[model samples]
Target: TVIRDEVGLSLDKADKAVLGTAAKVVLTKDATTIVGDGSTQEAVNKRVAQIRNLIE
Candidate 1:
């Protein structure tokens, strides 16, 4: 979907059903590569921001 692309996640498995039934948190490699960044938090935040942007 358009939202996925914005965050630079892989579209390799875009099918919603295949995406997983539980909550999805996508961690983009680019966000993780930021110097001195907290990888886990950065990933979670990026995913949350992406979803929030869609609804807002």
Candidate 2:
């Protein structure tokens, strides 16, 4: 049971990593048009929303 649980957790972590990577990709593509000398909070929020939409 312990081994099975560990394997399950590992799989979950891998899945989450993939999803996070995908989210980052989505954010990168969408956030490129944003213009500013520095990173903007609005851009980050927009990117996060876009990523969430992609996941859904």
Whose lDDT is greatest here? 1
TM-score of each: 0.33, 0.33
Model 2 misplacement above 4 A: 1-38
Please give the range of 10 consecutive residues that has the lowest summed lDDT in model 2.
Answer: 17-26
Count clashes in each candidate, considering only residues at least 3 apart in sequence or on different chains: 0, 0
lDDT by residue (1-56, candidate 1, tens digit) is 24365677667847775343433345696542223323478776886797687879
- lDDT values of the candidates? 0.56, 0.47
Give lDDT tens digits, candidate 2, residues 20-44: 3222222364563324424369966
* Model 1: residue 52 alpha-carbon error in angstroms: 0.6
lDDT of 2 at 8: 59
Error (Å) of candidate 1 at residue 2 is 8.2
